[model samples]
Target: KTTDILVQAQICAALNRHVIDVTTPNVGLQDWSNSAEYYQQSPCNHYAKFWDQQGISVDQLAYGFPYDDVFEYSSSVHTPSPSRVVVSFGPYTDGGGNDNDEDITGMGGNLSVQFTDSPAGEGFANLIDNDAATKYLTFNSSAWVQFQANNAYSLSSYSITSANDAPQRDPLNWNLQGSNDGVNWTALDVRSGVDFPSRQQKQTFQVAANSAFTYFRFNLTNNSGSILQLAEIELFGEGSSSGFSQTIQAENYSSMSGVQLENGAGAEADQNVGYIDTNDWMAFNSINIPNSGNYTVSYRVASEGSGGELSLDVNGGANVLGYRTVPGTGGWYNWTTVSHTIYIEAGTYNFGIFAQTGGWNLDSWTISLASGASAQSAATAFNSENSMLEIAEISLSPNPAKSQLQIDFTAEHANLTLLNAHGRLMESTSNVPSGSLLSISHLKKGLYFLQVEIDGKVTVKHFIKE
Candidate 1:
């Protein structure tokens, strides 16, 4: 079986043909096992051995992914930015304990204060100082610690660490508040009857909010005793303008038909979704799109079976936002990444990855909007070379062109071909004159690469189809 496989591969290489059905296991690199295995490693690590023997570069290789699998499925994004915080502490006032000044740098050199005196070593600043030996004790029920973020943000989660000392002094209940200004506050998160059994242990609480907030207040209501104390507080979130990536785990599909969640597969993000066949589909919904801009969506895919392709569409639309081809890696556990950049307006859209073809396993995928990459910059990669590709030399009028687009070239004639954002050919015309009109009304309303091939040299220009 191995000799025949090598022979076939050699013949295909000589004829400039590639095989999508053959992989490393077919040649016996790693023993094939039907049992559970890691699925997160790049699948093509063993391809170098074959290329080395044949003395051929891997870049020249191409693939024809089987798109026979078609299944039904269902999917948000938020960005971030830098943040500024103004600190303030105190009202009732009390610092007399063992030594509170030792924790001045605890809150990034921010101010700290408390109400009433600590018995001896306990101080308010010690509450967040991460020391069981040190504690912040407050007798008043109304004492609170607050932070005001200069650049407003929304938190997805928060955590608090308990002091290692007395459990009776640990904070039991608190209300998280957000405010534009300090005075008027809205409840963002609230905790009641929460307890910590072990000292110095941290517990996390999940909360949801989309509104930008400048001020956050943690109101300590009640504790195990009449006094309250805490070790640390942590807020996990981002500023409104910070661009971020959202990863969708393949196994977390809302509803998947003809697929299985392969567990203990060495996936860093839990199990992967595999067992794909024709008509298999997965679905994700309510993905957050925090801003409007060009975003790159990347997929981690693997397969030992025939290579395949997938299409990304929004809201169950027939129009594909992006399409990618998956080439075979050596084994089912081998993995590879495919990505596409496209422009999408700011809004929550149901993102779906449909198997135009099956035979591939997906680990996870992510979407990220790059900073400074706007709509115009998102118009695919295009260059006309010479002065022809220059803005003043060549004129493409009515940008975001609705109907017919006119291209006036300094030269007499140039070859023109239209390509999608992925650089795949959509339309081609050879030897079009200097001044010509092209009908792009039928094209999808997104970025397209227009290549002007002249004298066997290519110059490309990007334009939007309205």
Candidate 2:
């Protein structure tokens, strides 16, 4: 927030019910840890402000309740009904309540502009990416900027901020337009001979849309000189900011053009391709949740070698939804799905997928309401594939096996069966052939279990399907 602030909360089961302990410098899983040298920066510096609202004195509310003190995090909301549900979502742009100044346009679509040659990072991409430190600049005195709304929206108003330096580069004349397509535009607002005397100074304008529009255009012409620039742009409307469903296709992500995209089956995935890149990311903008609760995110992915990790970042910020490790499937074509639950405030947000280390392939991802889901579903989300095994001695060749697998065992003829992460049978082979190589190039990437029945001895081995 504005000033440096962090607090830790501790509630003792043994302590009398009314006593609460508080401390400084946040220490939590998503926030800063006790060992972390860096401080945590969240949207709210004082989640414990609720206590102050309740008239609890500072000395009495020692250490501060912190987030965990009052808010409970879980995949399901049925445990305790949420008092307030998120209602509306605006465009995930600056001046928009959802993004909160974090740039995220690099993850996906929704932005297009005329110029990008002013500064290395200051271009059309940076304009909507959410960082106020970076700005959009164009060499041409006249340029056009556009924003696409994946969903319909009712207009309210918007604002623009000037670059922190050089006031002469600001737009002197501009026109705002609304349209269903970028080709055809209708003027909504226009300004002539405008000026921002102070750098980074923001000027807002109010407007009303007669009907829902999916496209917004900002035409800037006749700037102070031979260049046009802006630090940020924001839009607001009556649009519901949260509680909506969105599907992100792996091949459709917005990242550096270097990321490789390959063909895929578009059955569960929206796009007919998958993507792979290191440190590159894909983003989904204007994700609206109907209510305040935990959302179960399901990802369909595959990897060939030792898999890597994937982290979910909201609005290009450090707010990690969760992290999941990708398991190796039998081949690059083999695909399987994994899931995790994350808590999100009911509102509009730009959700992004960052490749922590890379070498992971994604097919698609989906987010669904988890309030009605079973508790078991939430628990299983945390368990990794091949983490549990009862029989350890049996040697399985090619641990992160690809294409084929070899199982060596010393026992009488036994029955062999392969199961998926969900404990569902995928492949079965009987009549033990010790050290035999089995063709398993058809399995998807994930955790699989192998069960063997020999004499009276039963052995179960959990293996990675990579």
Candidate 3:
């Protein structure tokens, strides 16, 4: 069985990996290290009671002492608490005699409690427990326990513990407010209810909108005669911004024509000349080129036409380069080698291959740097069928000549033909130029191919008529 292998030329670019080093400015490294170390060990529990104290008011306490001294105070107050402590304040007056009548109006009945030396005070442990004592104190009607507001905050939940042993007097009333600049205020929520003696109850409020407020306050309107206690208060909301990063991969193949790898599949070859139709080509993976430089492209070709040629253009775009042609060797399955070095910039470039004349087969095309600094010469040995052709030595003079042409061949008998751009035979000479010159100054100014046939082997050389 015989098979025709259509090899499409593949052009690609690649970049090597690079390493970069970054350095920081020299400064007081000691200070920077100390600050970082200190911050790492700082207590995050500090924010737990961030809103517990603000302005001149105290909202809540971690631990408190009871009004009655019947219970013994534990020496180990540093223990963790299952719940937070609360403090309630109201007016207490002493009786006294009225000046106009004999009635006692100004009695020494007014009483008040100060937050002093109790585990429930400002300097208590980071956390409190349920077994902790609840602190309650009497105050004048003009007196109020200040609760700190965390800017504008939303309350998720709150718990209140009352003294069951004490008798209740006035109903306990509370109101929530937000303040900007810690002065102007807006009401958020309010509630009034009878106090539970020596019992715990929880209240929760949901915020409508997320806002920025510096001050929040929980005002106590009326406190039941019995001292009040609060177990815990919690506020929740979104606080920080989120970030995202994305990566993009770009490829450019606009400079390519006849042969191209579309959609990252394989290589495609165009057999017909003129405008190339890319619909019949194979796609391949994209190449990544780092910087612009010079590269040598090589490919295998097998053609059966007496004078068929293929044109390959590499790095074709605003700045085009790498233009060359591979001539037909008149045998199928005969591999021919052609190469060209082109300077390309650092970018994705497109390459194209077109059949200048008749159909041809292409295979194993690769672009890489030449072995040495000089331009890479054409291949001298190619595999054809089961044998390799040791290319015969042939010479052409005045390669960029203005008019004359010369050639030297080793074969005793040979046939030579000068063909123009349209594949039309311009001139033919036989058994001559074995080592002599052929004059033809009348030839038009353009590109032409010199075909020399010796035995069954053919050699094609390109010349420019300046």
Candidate 4:
């Protein structure tokens, strides 16, 4: 028969007999009597015969045994069923020990119990007794709890209260630590000397894996040992992290109505205008003007003493306009409006008010576009080139002329183009006689650009037709 058939037959024989003699003396005992005798001698002997038949030695059988009971009997002595298993129940004195009887009673699974003396002395026994209502652990002093590394965890909220009626402890403390391994830890934050009775505070900590930390802990550095307190701790920021940009506008002040002012004296003091001391000037943070136009500026100023004079610098176009001084009004709060009209060219300009006088009060300043008839008169007299160009002094005899408009140029020869408001050429003339008068009597009344090209340079003079 094949080895497989022979093994199968042996297995069937053992099963039918309901016992396998693996340790029968290798005297080649094939008889049932010899196998039973070997098994009776010892379980290991039976196991040896049974395995030897399969070409396994006693040691191999011992090593390869699947059942623990079989392996134990093969290597050690066998004990009969005992009446009871020894168990130690607690320090029944304070009712603070584990119940060992539960093991033999089979009421619950394997029970091994011990009693540890209460760290707290005296009547504190009730506090440590493992009863349903009173079982709790208390740390009368500062303590630290360590958590496993590389894992995210949270803390439970805790409270601290003063034990004494009076303030025995002035401050309490707590801190948090994170660690990659159990041994090395990094302190995240610490709070010290906290007044527990007055304020209840809570804190949280988030430890990142990138910080090479895997553990976290809370250390109660100090606390008032009066009442039981706890804190709830939570962990976040496991996978995401978060961060700001600011835009600042350039400082400028150009508008007529939006001028800002700063004064060190009383509210009724006049403002010192013109010069801007970097330390005392009120400046605008930005200049966003819609369009540029001629702006008129005026300010009120006064000095502290009779001889006290405040000088201010008016700046524009890469240069100072002029410095003006305000004479004193002879009293502490005395003030006056010393005003001037400044013709500001069309463009954004930064300006500020500063005082040179030691002790003076300045206040109520008004600046705006020249009003009404003065504006019209000023616009009329302002020359385009004011004698700089060789063009004949342009004169409109009767400026509010009803009919013919006259123009004169001093050049021997010139090119001229009378353009309408939109700069469209309405009339053009070349080789104009020197000091000769040109007339445009046919045009209707409105604004026009009298562009005169003299010696290849263009000078545009704005005028109105009557």
Q: Give TM-scores for every candidate, taking all chains together and pairing residue i with residue i.
A: 0.35, 0.34, 0.23, 0.21
lDDT digits (tens) for residues 4-85 of candidate 2: 2223232221021232223534422232221111111222323232222211221113233333332222112353666877
Show where candidate 3 strays beyond 4 Å. 1-132, 141-152, 163-171, 194-198, 205-210, 223-466
**Cα RMSD of predicted structure 1:** 29.5
Best by TM-score: 1
Whichever of 2 and 4 has more TM-score, that candidate is 2
- The candidate, 2 or 3, that scores higher on TM-score is 2
Question: How much is the lDDT of residue 257 in candidate 2?
Answer: 34
Off by over 4 Å in 4: 1-293, 307-317, 354-359, 372-466
The candidates, ranked best first by TM-score, are 1, 2, 3, 4
TM-score of 3: 0.23
* lDDT per residue as tens, model 4, 281-400: 333323222111122334455555652333223442233332334566765445665543233333344544444343444443444433221223223223433545544454434443
Q: Alpha-carbon error at 409 in model 4, in Å?
A: 31
lDDT of 1 by residue, 175-287 (tens): 88877656899888888888898876668776675576556678886564577777666555544556668988887777667788886355454688888775677878898
CA displacement after TM-score superposition, residue 302 of candidate 1 (Å): 0.8
**CA lDDT, every model vs. true structure:** 0.58, 0.57, 0.37, 0.37
Per-residue lDDT of 106 in model 1: 20
